[model samples]
Target chain A: MSPRQFDQRHPHPRPDDDSAPPPAGSGAQARDTEVDSLLEEIDDVLETNAESFVRGFVQKGGQ
Target chain B: MGVVTVRRVMGIETEYGLLGVGNPAANPMVMSAQLITAYANEGMPGSARARWDYQDEDPLRDARGFRLDRAEADPSLLTDDPQRPAPEGDLHRVTLRRRPGPQPEPATVANVILPNGARYYVDHAHPEYSSPEVTTPRDAVLWDRAGEQVLLRSSRLLAQIAGMPEIALYKNNTDGKGASYGTHENYLVERAVPFEDIVAALTPFLVTRPVICGAGRVGRGQRSEAGGYQLSQRADFIEAEVGLETTLRRPIINTRDEPHAESSRYRRLHVIVGDANQLEVSTYLKVGTTALLLWLLERRGLPMELAALRLADPVRAAQEVSHDLTLTRRLDLEDGRRMTALEIQRTYCEVLTEAVQHAAGGEAAAPDPAAEQTADVLARWADVLTRLGDDPASCAREVEWVAKLRVLEAMRRRDGLGWDAPRLAALDLQWSDLRPERSIYSRLVAADAVERLVSEDEVAAAVLHPPQDTRAYFRGEAVRRYPGAVAAASWDAIIFDIDGAPALQRVPMTDPLRGTRAHVGELLDAHPDPGTLLATLTARPPGPQT
Candidate 1:
């Protein structure tokens, strides 16, 4: 095999436009807000169950 | 979605724990070399007579398309002289960086390439084994575990030779002191993708990945941070976001540009954030998911929704997340929002699940092996995170940290011991003991309390052979059949000393997937001798130009 065979590191060269990742900038900023909002809800649940959370930490793992 | 087209090369390099057996004052460097010698005498693969070619090793090369000044590279390497007198105390106290007389001849530096296509050698006081490249995550698991078996067998062999079983090996990163070794993973990525894109998309995923795969540690901190039990052992040691150094100022995204394959065609993603896992599932997912994420990053990058899930401060986040036993500690995301590591990981999981569904279609179809493995990893990753979300204790049997914690926590409850109890620390260290008779992980496996993926037979076979689908085949076969005449081997090629030949013949394995068993098995069967094999390879036009 030639070096050219391994040289193609750009992953897949052809990506269907429709399946490509979302556009950056405004689109990214907007998506970030939604993800952050979703995260806020989960953080609230974590806070409510704070006692169980602390217990889980030490009892679960480190070694 | 286009027929699941992905198969990235994966490999691991680990520094095994070395102990001074029988003699407490025994020098570790001397003991380590003895272990290698014992294994070599036992006829283990990659004998000292067989060498490792360092023609292409450039640790100063960075993934960001540039090379660091050679002087800036860490000089803490395996430059020690075995014949030299040991320092008065603490052999390591003598800074290896000091110019110690004239540099030892490069030929004197010891290296062995095992028949399994792995490299076993001393890396400054530590015995490191770098596994051969494999195509699948499962293969990665098999090969990494194979390294453990090699070390374990060597440990036993040393015991028999020295007449004492005092030398026990542990697959741990730290000595519970201020020092840290590495359980480093490497993945081949498309070099066309900008380095910035990889760092941006992978930093948070890598930081939080330990939640699932972390080998739980006993005491907290390394060098700087204070003590506390946490999810990962190596987390506290990391100090940078991007850099070429590994020993000092460790980076989350290592910049070591040693691709091991063709340089321009491949940029190895040297991952150092992960823990050395005990559970099979933990290691499988640790490698499997990372390969999937790398595939996605190379192809399309993370979706906008997932891309913005970055940590505001990665170094601080990695430290807090490790000690956050609660696994719910709030981390500042780049988007000015506070979230737990679990939630951030869950975000990536959710996006990946969608990608899997889209690629697999309505009925979970993986057109290729990579897609199939990626699909399996996503399912397991999602389940693990969900369990970690509700009750981490529920997933104790599957995740490495949780399984170890289950065993440790039980002892705590039964014996009325605190987390800092002497017994607890002892138990923690025993979990990583390489001896099956002493390893907590081994006990767990025997009792069927934890998941087991790779079997003992496969691991034993892997010890004596190399992967059939990569250049490792040629490397391993040549060494296995001709241990003496095989002059030296490297990831990219092997140099064979053909008897009566004009010059030492070199075979370039530029392509990681080529020169595999399917490609070279016939040639190997046809020629039992190195001279004839070299002649065949040279006469053939199918392989890379020598």
Candidate 2:
């Protein structure tokens, strides 16, 4: 019923190490490789004419 | 009835972005109608393309206790009337002539109530698929994904035709131009709750919900005029805090109060602020968390602290929260306190968690399936909020905006391009392409880049059948078994015209919880014919109902 009761009954679980920087070791390197490969896949399928495709995709307003 | 959980009658309506490939000038009205016709004729051959019954619809009736004058109302708000093209127009006649098979009448093809109990029709210039009513968030995601399958199959069917232009469907909100469509969420709330209570309690929650469920966008403005990434696609288009208009002066909390059920007991909360999400967890938590809050509101009224957390300017707060990519932007509350979007969301989650525990008498174990689902939603909500506070990149698998931002950032890094790059906007549009081959989201799912809650089999089954727990089962079964006898159907009634009946037999399903498979399964089987079914239903003595 009140914020005081909420704090006592269920303590908020704000992550303790909130300001820890993002990992910059092998994990970051591995993620980079993954993104590179995903971008490669996207390149194969992305529309060749980006400007026209993006420009031509007009739609009538809807609810 | 004992304790309110997250389980309630809910549905999702998605207005898919349609485009004619290689033909920029194609009429969307005709193309949208053709897409529906192609699906009903070819995708679902034997099923009846029932006309949408507009007898119960009243779109101009506002939930804030007044109805707008019909003349002053926007033309798009006139949904009760049939939207059809000219009878002998060139588009209609040419489309009819090109088809090689026995085609449905152009008027009838505009709307088809599927065997899955969903409505596939053209609203405005977009092809919309309204999922059948379901009780849980999981089923909501299932039927919503079933709609994606419906679009995919319909597009495939149209592709096989020789001369028909290949129409591509995007499960997104905007065309990146000035126009923005919608993906609306509907929740059934008790009529006793005041409209002011809903606005006061739910505004901050909706303003901050983008942190959890936003389908990310590549541009900052409605017309993509500004070059920056935002958390939500529909956020910039929202210009009002509350209104009855949908197409113009879009609102955060829509006041359209046309409850398709018993009006005295319920009001369907027509939510229009959400983006069309492709991620399952986003859709799941989007519906789940909101339902839990409504349950709290219905059972115990708005908690005092929640009312005090109202934003100073909700309309401005909505856009600020969307544009803040850091997820740390502080919003001003009416009490002169500042809270980040994550903080406000966590407050709601914590309160609901305590309420659920109290409902179960402090027992850790769930008492029922519904409670168990609520527990799951709370746990996911807590985990996502914690991760968002600590490191947003960790939620790439669960949160849609994070997942999409990861992809866009990677593309930006690889090409050495800014957010204004045409390729980035193109990729944003392609992220929601319904085709698996071209969709970036699909590729993420395939590569285990994103998390999934429902299986493909579950979504596929939902496409062919309705959930067994709601009245949709009765509606879906009637349409599937006796397609010929069903003249029209709506959310609350089904009109049956038998071969030798005296007149059209109307079956009123005013209650959303009634007409389940358990209530009418044996009856449906015993009376295979519509005449016998109607006779037995009418002959039964009326009893006291829930």
Candidate 3:
């Protein structure tokens, strides 16, 4: 086994690409919006019937 | 349209420690059960009061669209309440009555619920999360996140719960001395993949898993010299064995042995890696990157060229991986190629990123734009780790956590303690003789034997004895003390608490007869009393064997 190294430290540089796709700003932002919209709809349902949702969802996989 | 690749939901379960303040006689398990029931009855959406009292909550829903409860009481950990009103002045306080409330029906309490609607609970003393069988790759990732949310929520809730000691949920295997505890992760693989093939491909990366996924650290050197740094992220504690035989001794990556009804079929890979990372980033990368590697294997992108990548001492390897960055040492691959820990990790991430991109696009397909970006982030993370090897002064939270761990480990060593040291087997040996039916003498002899052995090992290890050898010696001592537990060999653990005592510590095997009797009763009630547990402790019995 390699011995452990504990003292080495370096400052991390910022990413060079501002236009990086998917996981970066634009793609993640778009995904976040979609998730928010979906969550809102679910929340609306929850406001009226939290118990039914819990029962139905919890029953998906047997306890 | 071309066949769309999908991800499935997966999750993890965490158990909490329970306490009863002021009352020294409080039973931790009963308290945990009560706390769990209380949380469960608070309903899927906790009332404002419930949320204030309990700290954990998750917005994600499980497959049934039910919110899962990520973290709950282990129903095993025992502790005394420090603040219990003592009519008489003594350390052990009186037992308290169960609080009045609507208890969760037996069925609901049997398994805990996560905000995601997933259920998790304790099987034996350990908290277990059996991931919901996933249907798509994306869901698998989401499930892991959901599971983590539960853990985070549970951690907070446990902190808020009254009369409980601070609970630490280790995500790694035991040091093999007392109880080889650890965290486990599962992934569904194509059934056609043989276990041997999976092991062959996975071992190399597993050796280097710490690089991209290792939470950064700063700590004293593993070598006993006055002052050197330890670089590997995984080498903070002493633990051996990459895998443990489950309670059933089933292969770590168990074979379902059943054919799937659907045209698309796969087997689940259950991996037990002793990694308990404090950082969410570390947890995310640990699960995410490993899953990607599994995907890489499924796509035939893994290279088995490094067949000789065996570690002479995996226990050492496990410890070396957890050290903070001041230590520098080279590991020799099977081919005798010496590589720095960082170099190995960088190469692994680079290889995996390329493989993921290729597989995502299909045969010679254009790289998915999303994968390309993720690959870059992973590469940078690895690079940062490599450059920052073991610098204690470094300020990254991940690095500091490791540093603090190293400090704790140092304290253990100075105080003659071994994490996951070999005394565990001896402890099991004594506990083995402690069936509810066994004579108190047998139980006392077993528990005392373990406590004595662990104490000796701790002393020896404090004098700079090697951890692996020390643990091995403890295992040998356990066999000598209680030959029956070893022969019958039930690795299951029974947890109980004395009526009084605030330390929240596991009972020493060397305890007096009365404590051992209580422990035995607790064991019998919680789990089936093992018939062979008594004789299992002796190393070599001279008399007639059971």
Candidate 4:
């Protein structure tokens, strides 16, 4: 199935610029932009002390 | 034609992973209780006092037609009794004693039956949300998402309390340490279908189900000591093919026989092998396909191919399937044949597809919602298995493991880091964080990187109202309308202590299909007071009361 048909069946989040579809063959570039922005966002809010944070996350066993 | 569909009584229970922002040493028991209390007391008023009625719960009774002796049972198996944190100076003493003054009263609200027909309570050290029963998988995903909103609200309210440490909840199964909690799914099955039949027919399906719905893990072993990723978070933790114990020797098919319904007719299949999924599509298919499989077993006896497709060692195969990211590892069968996990899943899917068509008798019936949904699940199941076989990356929109792997791979490629990087492990944990600002999955949802099966409004509405098709409607409505008189409630009964009644009024809802909105909505609306409602219900004719 085409991406549009799949999106129609299972709804995807509408992009910010929904007024017009991107020009041909821009799908790869659009995905790269999305990944880059996500990484940039993660860099700001990710926990600073990664090693200690990972080590200290101890949980009691549960069912 | 016999009804062959995914419509069955199914529900999900999630045990959230909680962490104190700065106080890593805080007692999880106390913190979990505080989270429940915060939600009940401040988030939803008048729900704080409705205690859970555990009279019908018999956790030791096994579906294998026997009961383990209480002396031999694990302490975690004794779940009927009210669980209180150990008292002061005990072995498990409360560690939230940082203040110089006298110790404050422990958070007393351990359990509350919500207006949404859910049980928000503390199960051991983690806050558990047991959703109300829903008959369809789409509703299953909606209500499960509602449970997440419950946790998010509880966290926000608890953080506002004076001197209360900020708590973050994760919709995940493991802590990347050895300790693993559960995100269990329950399906109502006919008791006439012997337990052994279920065990035999369901083992291979459960062993290979992770290819579609696994919430990816960053490390190999349960302790995260190994330096690799896997498809499932709970695969390494599974040690048994079938057993009664859940905390130790975790089983693929848990034999807990607590139906919480008419014991003679229904047996609630307690499934503990699944990960707590975040994507809506993952949760939808996880429940939908399983329900369809159970329908197939109940209607038509196990297909010949399914009967012959038993794994040689299901426990080992479960882990092998998870670890094989290439999606091409062959698993050995008991019949001396080998097949990849994808092939096994495809066999089940194809069997059900043919069964559904045969049941229809090549005649087009009028459009039925249940049959349509079953067809939808079958189509999606086939689509997912086919896509996974082609390229696992193509399934990022609908598969939880694939979606998570994409984000992790993106980060690794950008930073030139290996699987052992602490940043990647931390990112894995934060992906499940409840806070939208901190969760990478939430960021993906916002970026339209994921697909959604339901809308935000549907989830929000489910948070306030229970599904109108099950006995949960009566339970949720009674709690919502007459909060002052609902003394306690369980799966099959509700106890009301009206002011002038000689004794407590007990109403037994033995049938899960009855007591729905169609049965008692008007009765509930007619009587604003619990006393009159009880009187009217008792005064009705004694023949087949709705």
TM per candidate comes to 0.82, 0.91, 0.46, 0.91
User: How far in Å is the alpha carbon of B231 misplaced in model 3?
Assistant: 8.4
Q: Give a tens-digit lDDT track for model 2, residues A20-58.
A: 444534344556677677888888778899989998989
* Model 1 ranges off by over 4 Å: A1-63, B45-48, B77-109, B162-165, B223-227, B361-368, B542-546
Candidate 2 runs further than 4 Å off: A1-29, B1-4, B82-104, B362-367, B541-546
**Poorly placed runs, candidate 3 (over 4 Å):** A1-63, B1-10, B13-28, B45-108, B126-180, B211-244, B247-264, B304-308, B312-316, B323-327, B357-377, B389-546
How well is each residue in B74-191 modelled by candidate 2, as lDDT tens digits? 7788888635311211210101111124355664378889999999998999999999999999889889999999988988888887888798899999987889999999999999
Interface RMSD of each: 16.7, 9.1, 23.6, 4.7
Chain A TM-score for each candidate, in the given order? 0.33, 0.55, 0.33, 0.52
| TM-score of decoy 1 | 0.82
Q: Best candidate per lDDT, number?
A: 4
Q: Tell me the whole-model lDDT of each prediction, alpha carbons only.
A: 0.70, 0.83, 0.34, 0.84
> Against the hidden true structure, what lDDT does model 1 obtain?
0.70
Tens digits of per-residue lDDT for model 4, B1-546: 236678899899999999998988899999999998888888777642678877667888899989898788888888886353212121111111121233454557899898989999999999999999899898899899999999999999999999887999999989888999999999999988878779988999999999999999999888987888899989999999999999989999999988887678889999999999998889989999999889888887677899888999999999999999998999999999999999999999999899888887856666666777787888889988986876566677889999888778788989999999989999889989999988988877876777777787778999989899898988888888888888788777777877766666667776787778988888888999888888877777321135
Q: Using DockQ as the measure, which candidate wins?
A: 4
Record all residue pairs in model 4 with backbone atoms less than 3 Å apart, i.e. clashing.
none
Candidate 1 lDDT by residue in tens digits, B164-229: 445767787776656778888989988877788788888988888889999988787763234447
Classified by CAPRI criteria, candidate 1 counts as incorrect
Residue B463, candidate 4: C-alpha displacement in angstroms: 0.8
- Which 10 successive residues of model 4 chain B have the least lDDT summed? B90-99
